[model samples]
Target chain A: MALTLDQRSASRRESRRPAGPRPVRGGQSPLARRQRRIFGPFLAIPLALYLVLFIGPTLYSIYAAFTNWDGINTPTWRGTDNFTALFDDPLFIESFWNTLLILVVVGIGIFVLAFSFMLLLRDMKGKGFVRGVIFLPHIVSPIVLAIFWGFLLRHDGLLNALIVKFGGEPVAWIGPDSAFLMIMIAMVWISTGFYVAILMAGVDRIPGYFYEDASLAGASAWQKLRHITLPLSWDVIGVAAVLWTISSVKVFEFIYAFGASQGQMPPAYEWNAAVFVYGVTFGGATPQYRFGYACASALVMLLLVTGMVALLRRAMRRDAVQF
Target chain B: MTRTGRLRRSISFAALGLSALLAVSACGSPSGPGDSAASGEFTYWSMWQEKEPQAQVIKAAIDSFTKDTGIKVDVQWHGREVMKKLTPSLRTKAAADLVDQSMNQLGNGLSNTGQSADLTSVYNLEVPGEGKKVSDVIPSKYVDYLKDKEGKPFMVPYEVTGEGLWFNAKQLPTEQPQTWDDLVKLLDAAKAKGVSPLALDADNTGVAKYWPLLTLIRAVGPEGMQKLASDRTGAAWDDPNVLDAVTRVEKLVKGGYFAPGYNSGQYPAQQNLWAQNKAAYILQGSWVTSETKTYAAQGFEYSSVQLPPINGGTDAVGVNFFGFGIPKTAANGEAAGKFIAYFLNKSRLEGISTKADNITPRADIPAPAALESLSKSFQEKAVYPSGAALGLKFGGWESTAFQPVAQSLVQGKTSAADFVSQVKAKSIEFWKTQG
Candidate 1:
């Protein structure tokens, strides 16, 4: 009777267990518990620290926008005057329009290339090598990257040598007419690797079984990609767009590095909003140091980015399409 | 987290916070401005930018001053971005006693902030460099930049510079251009040979890049460039001589004698044209020697000739001062004055000139062998200050306005007359606020 009871207990345990699913943690917290845990001190400290460091300074900067502090003295209130000047300042307008154009044109151009490369990433030969080369620009310091690019693109630089080899005159890569374009190309080259890697990660997350099942259903490669890859990477693409938008708006190191080194300020196209602000503040013999003006410009940019982030989040919001 | 872990993290964070706070406090600490020389400890700030050796030479000179007089100069060597930092400080009264002359900064920056000391007394006082004593050493043409509007002395002269026609002798046809026409002929030669033409950094540097214009105006005598600076609509642009000078720069660019891309830089724009040998001939300054000897990658036998007279323009180089001034509040003002006097003395000036590779502004100190030789013939033949050149004050914004308009001229989008007229109109507009 005892032996029978022991065998019965073993059989009961076996019956309770289930199969045909991926492994996961058996012990889990309830919704109420998990939500509360996130607010616990361990998480709160780090979250608060980030909020204070990045967000606090940003908020403070916004407040300072309407003030006339020369960076040395305490700030004094001045209403929308700085903003008013920024709009009328012809150079500021040119800089603003130019930067916007760059953000859109280069951002779109790079995204297409970056996404295509991401879809091509699977089973690609020498994938690590390819990724490393593409990603190097994003990893290096902007100063080093800018200096190298400047050397490559100067009139007597290596690019001219290549142009000569191709039977064309040594065109000034940083000339007034072409400076903005070369800058765009360089920026895209530097930034796309990052966007591509992110999209690739999204592509990697889409279960292979989905593609396998689609293939079994006689789906073509194009059909599989259209169905699975695009939908899966949409969120990542949105994020890349938002990031590149902000980055391209305030592009500085490149413009400064590549400004026609000797002559006229590299024809006006290179003057983005940041360059314009800098030129106004510090370009001449005695900097006007219009702190209020600069702060207002920054606030405009900050508000622009904030609005975009909110908009992007809204646009990207959809039921997480579970397969 | 365990109690131990929590304790450790807190301790570490507290330590970091304390360290950061300490760093900030330390950075904020400064000796209050009330040191009235009672302690005799003073900080001497120098706005010099050069390589390590030159800085060391300056340090040695300071040490010599300290040894000769019991006063000290705690020299803080600021680099090239001196104006960016120095200007704000001066506006706020946090400035050093002495500053150097930047390309655009002379007097306007100080006056603009309404903080310029009453320097009238300093100006009227007899300067160390004057007449035969200092004039002989410095190129006489440079004296005008140092003179105030009322012909009173303002900036104390340091290094003298002159704009000359430079060429990569190696790329040239074994002959020096004797006049402005001869140089143009060389550019024509290079274009004919299918090589790069005479390089001109016709980029954006005013007065410097427009050497032909300024020289032509100066050569045209007192009524030339100055009249243009003050006159709207370039009343003088049609002066037959002015037209010739305008045509010279345009002619060179159109002739394709310049490198593939010239007339596109900001400060010292014409420099790159000569440095790269993209243009075979560059009409630039004696400072080219400094640029060439320092950055050897610029590749060339950088040599200069007095810019040839244009049609009948003066065959002369425009020279200017890299000046120094002693602020009255100098903690060691007496010693500072002594140092300034010694620095201007031919012996000490020669010491610095040798190290700086600059032509001494004082007539007493001779230029080093190489510079002396290059400047010799021209120093004999050059014209002094042209009455027509726009008298530049610090904070002058022509640099910003003139560049685009001038570039438009180079591109043939604007006429030389328009550029000249625009300059005059802009000058008037700028002066209105300060007038």
Candidate 2:
């Protein structure tokens, strides 16, 4: 019966194809000619725009990285000086370290929390409502979240006020030693929800019969999750990991808005690679306008992220588990 | 034809129409050098927002200039980020004929880049209906202080801002301290009375640097501060005077003189605390008076004193000027110059003091009540433009090297000696990258 149904659907798909002039061997079909005529103009505009707006600047930035361009001034070739100087820059080094810390540390915190929530919600009543609640923070603007986070953690802010009210001494939650940690925590909190949703969608696709069968065979919840759920959701998890790898590197505005004071960038200790680029080029009371140097740092970040994503893809690759 | 096919064709046509509309509209705006000039309209990009008091005063002056000279002016209130926006426009014909910003910003963005026009002619241009030339009414010292790298005047002064120890007269009416020791004594007395001696928004590196920079400027002279900032080897930080300044900062930190959590909270937090009488003093710019006005304690009377002299150091006050400059490529440079001269007229310039609560370069105009003491200091003391300007010349030295070290010292995270060492190390590291 399934074979007959497959053949019927295949015949229907075959019927949907345009009945047009047959292709002259080694030549052309009328449909191909017509498709080219219709879509060629459509494709050309965006392709041209993409080249001009995106690819052109990308290529220019790669070139700019080797020069001493100050945006307005004509660029002069400095060879590898900008790239070499980056290693000597304490700010760039600290920012590079901070960016890596966020990617690995905050990245782990997000995935672990997301997976746990995905499991917890699978059996919970009103799981949709609970999921929606968990996802709320993802929708709010990061700037607004940063402000709210500041008010909660700042000295004499709400949390401190509450502590003082309870006869406890106020603590500097966002002090120099702890500000970056607080930022990382806020990042994890903000990010876990989106990952949970991605993960939940992946978990939802598993057939219920596998869990039922495992249960009848006296399989435990952990066993079912480990054996069935994780394997089924592996591809989605891989995609989510890649998504996070890219997004984490791009985390700028939250830290920028949170740590900033009087329109100046946050202190150097709190900066990530993204903020480092902005600080050197166009940020602060007087912009440094080191376009070439900024581009070099940016290129470094780009290469590192690309290499990391590639490694991640290799690590996550596995044979698909078809049920 | 299939409905879907027909729909797809219509969608493509709509997209094509949209792109055509966008392309046409993009070309419709008047941009390019000489366009406004040929139309006989002067274009100005102001550094003040339209709603700001400074802009209101300038807007009135622009209106009067147009009325008196019959020259139409097109103004865009680009606010504080005007320099960032104006830089790209400099290479294009779209650049404003006139722009205004702090001297340091102009130095970094335009004058240093040779984008500013020499405004010596404008300075000599006579004020409309006033016999005095623009240079005669405004002090030459200001002109000299804000001159371009080539020692040519590029910007005309309108508003003057200076940094000092701000206090509320209603709360602490003590006489101004003359020496660093006396200042410390005053802070101790204020602390003994259960008031936080100082308010520091240490998170704001710009404001946080004030304590160290002021101390350094007072210990060594402005030139000394400039030398340390511009030092490529970073060995200048090892100077005894730099140590003295850092030591004073350490003393303040160890004494617990700063408001609680000063290093943790963002700006305006500690400043607001100072306004509420949670702290007795705050080292800030002249603008602090107006900025904290709304949040001030009832019966608050804003007052300030010049940073006290340290170890018989020169009594030079640090002043920053906000002013106007005509770009080199300006088409309507003559008209812009006339407007600048007209704006300097005492009757028009007084609005900067009266309405804006700021000190104008015109010494004849009485300063606003809050800034009276700062204005007096500027007149009586030997003035040096803020070290911030010199710091910028060294390429990110202020933000990247000095600010972080200063922050560490003020935050009590490092000792004075450690601070100096760290600064020396960071400065050397910073200058290495400048190559």
Candidate 3:
């Protein structure tokens, strides 16, 4: 079946030519037309659902923010009064500051720990087992973790018991000054492992040959990380940052469970934005049902987080680094 | 397939989809649980968890009502955290016919907002199979706590409650302290024994802050406490009696009477520590008996003494009855009222004290031996009803203004004078929001 060079060249030339479009597939079969018609309604169902369930309530909350709706009665329009009251209230101010503190402080702490862990774990032995052990807290219910944390820090708790055994005075680890600090630390502990796992996944995707090439070029660990790992994993790190920002603002169970023994609501000083919303609406010995006021506070948090996320995406944007 | 066959199949599918949508939309519509006109059946929301001894007793009484009326009853055990659930549910179609809640909770509940029914008729209704009406058996003081803003009865009183200094009889001095100075002396002596004088959970601002509040009640009569609470001029807080009360709270905080780390400690932890005889005393309500039943140290008998009168002020102890209220939205309001009357019968209410180990609101029903000492002493001790029950101008003023500041005072972050000014300022703000 050996071909002459001229015949082979003729066949290659014919293949290189662009072919004309084939006759329109059976001129659009009736079945195909039916499928196209059905596809729209199926898509519309979910779209309509999303509009009703999510978007509808979100819009309603915006309207409610400017009114005084006690859940049981007609809501009176009170333009900007709720916002004024919320700002004037010391409790709301404390909660706002605490939420921001957790967002920034705990966020930085988690990112640093996770990034470091991901780096160390990249070349470490038994990384799988170590990752699993650390990520265990994310799987456990937060209320359970809060209980164990509260138990460890209480006056006659396990930590104090151990301290007393060594002839040391018990520490007031759960005191008002330290309670929020412990919560922040616990949040960092619970959140870091999940972020690390995400980061490591991103790091693992880079071709081994890139690292080999860098090593041959005499790249140090820090240089390899700075020039190679950081650029490649920027997208995932951005996603993780956004995720942490949203979740850290919504933290309720850990702090709420810390005050479970007190009653329905925690001490006002320990409250954050989420707790504040719940307290104003459904929490505490009496339900204030300040849905309007709570909605105003909620809108503030929503706007803040949304603005931060936008800024973060801008900061993290880079041209895709193709392998 | 044939075109006609495809058309029929598509039509059937469309019909099925339409039917499903109809069913779902119908279910979404709120048809509030039908209120029973003739009382065939009803629902009750009891604010006790399933395992609590109180829940069992409440269930027994409910069962008796069901048997007598032949009306099926559904009970949802919501526990003590029921307020968070009950308040919202009151506005919904699924509102229960009856909800058992604390009388003090009335100050902060749907009852406060006039969402609850006027059960004054229930108070007038005769206890089933009993010769006397509801008012005849229950103490007037308990009934007094049941009044609404307009002086109408909105809730029925059942289980009685009192807050006083609870101490383990075996651990503390046999004789009661006669004055505030003497009380400090006793605390100092207890501290010398390597025991903290008080086991307090400042984190539990509701119950723990009552230590200072009840002292105020003792220093200033209930009238004076009310005057200070309602006064907008800020002069009431400057009253020497009010200063004496704040000083009383300040001394305890600064003196380290409470166990170490108490301001940060969780409740039940401190309460339990007190039960284990780790501290000399704790400020708690009568229900502490049932609350600490599991953690009880063997031979630990609970004894309480009213806070002694200070500066010749009235020697009143804080006492209010805990009971159920029928929401205006109840599906079976009439039946709910009847159930309240039946539940408060002399025979039925005795179980409250016997099985539940709580004080019964009925004067005829004596407290169980565990609380007999306090019950006997309460006859001699003047009762200072909570300001809320007495129609105070504000709801949760104690929780919002008094407690947080009391915490600051205790932590030495604020002095007695500063506490007064801060509270007065808070009161002004709170009053501005009241309307």
lDDT of 3 at B329: 66
Across residues B94-166, which tens digit of lDDT does each residue of candidate 3 receive?
3677787767565556566666777777777789989788888776666675677787776776777777678
Cα lDDT over the full model 2: 0.85
Writing each residue's lDDT as its tens digit, candidate 2 over B1-435 gives 544676789899989999997885554343323233444578899988999999999999888787877889999999888988988766544368889988777777777766777888888888877899988988887777767767878789899999989998987864878878888888998989999999999888778778888888888888888888878888788778779877888988998898888978877899999999999999998889998999999999988987788878878788899898888767677778878988988999999999999999988999999998889989987888886465457657777777877888888888999988888888887777777
Across A1-323, the per-residue lDDT of candidate 1 in tens digits comes to 44455456657766766786633332344665666666678787888898989888778778778887555456788777667656655456777777877878888888888867876777598876887788989998777777677668766667777998999876666665666787788888888898888877778888888888998999987888788887876777677778887788778877776664432244555678777666655654334555666778877876777787788788877666765
Candidate numbers sorted by DockQ from highest down: 2, 3, 1
> Candidate 1 DockQ category?
incorrect
- The lDDT values for all models are 0.59, 0.85, 0.77
Native contacts matched by each model: 0.14, 0.63, 0.35
Best by lDDT: 2
Report the candidate with higher TM-score, 1 versus 3. 3
Off by over 4 Å in 2: A1-32, B1-39
Query: TM-score per candidate, in order?
Result: 0.72, 0.91, 0.88
Tens-digit lDDT string for candidate 2 (A1-323): 44455467657766765668744522557777777767967998999899989999999999999999877778899999998888988788889999999999999999999989988999899999988888898999999999999999998799999999999988989888999999999999999999999999999999889989999999998898899999999999999999999999999989988998666789878999999998888788777788899999999999999999999999999999987
* Model 1 CA RMSD to the hidden true structure, in angstroms: 11.4
What shift in Å separates residue B3 of candidate 1 from its native position after superposition? 29
